[model samples]
Target: MSNVTSNSPSASNAVKPLDQGEEAVVRALHRVIHALPRAMDAELLREQGLPLVEYLTLMNLSETPGRRLRMNELAATCGMSLSGMTRVVQKLEAQGFVQRIRCEQDGRGWNAVLTDSGLARLEQAWPTNLAATRKYFLDHLAGLDLEKLAAAMRKIAT
Candidate 1:
């Protein structure tokens, strides 16, 4: 009664030769993971007036020896260009959150230091940020799944 051909395993299917279900699953996983950082960044920016990139830079400096890191090193750690990092540092400096100083070992190089204000801001944001991460990401995955995902990501990243 129907014109459509029945191409079960008995007959050769004319459609796609291979199933793309795995690719679809991979893409969905990628999207969910990618959306997380963007959402967290938006929340922090809206509530604290600190962009994620700026916060990451400040946090990195805060954890470093003397709460200072060379400008280039900070840029690399934050995955930003030197000029982009300079602009962010300028904004942080304006807000009294950070300061740029000459590197003690190399006068030609500059360092970005996280100020008390910067540390305080990070402190204020950290709990909520971490909670959001736990609620959205960690709480959903089993320990084994987390471990597997981490291993898979590390393999891909390398």
Candidate 2:
């Protein structure tokens, strides 16, 4: 989804390679994109028994007005497939951390509702998540212009 385009001088139109600086940035960004989540996930799982995806799902639901979101909406918000979100919700439900009910506006759709237990669990894991985020990601940005970095990231995301 990046706006990057192939720049080929040859008739065959093969894509040109990134310059050294661009390649370095791309590789580092890609590694951080993956490694950060795995590091945080491992920490959370070890310390709090909650996977990063489940925490994100619960956190997203908690932020909604009624602490609930339609399954598809939650999936989008969490950047997960519908089936993946369903499985995470099922696990959370089995743990008594969430409840699934028919959506009021459309009974055919299900909503994931964060329960009291879920909130407690999130709160319990919040510190660990925060610590891991700081350790694996934030601390590395010590003197950088965060606003600019955030803007760049937003641009890439869009």
Each candidate's lDDT (Cα)?
0.83, 0.93
Task: RMSD for all candidates, in order, please.
Answer: 7.6, 3.7
Measured against the true structure, the TM-scores of the candidates, in listed sequence, are 0.77, 0.89
Off by over 4 Å in 2: 1-17
Q: After superposition, how far is residue 96 of candidate 2 from its true place, in Å?
A: 1.1
For 27-55, candidate 1 gives per-residue lDDT tens digits of: 77789878987877887777777678887
Best by lDDT: 2
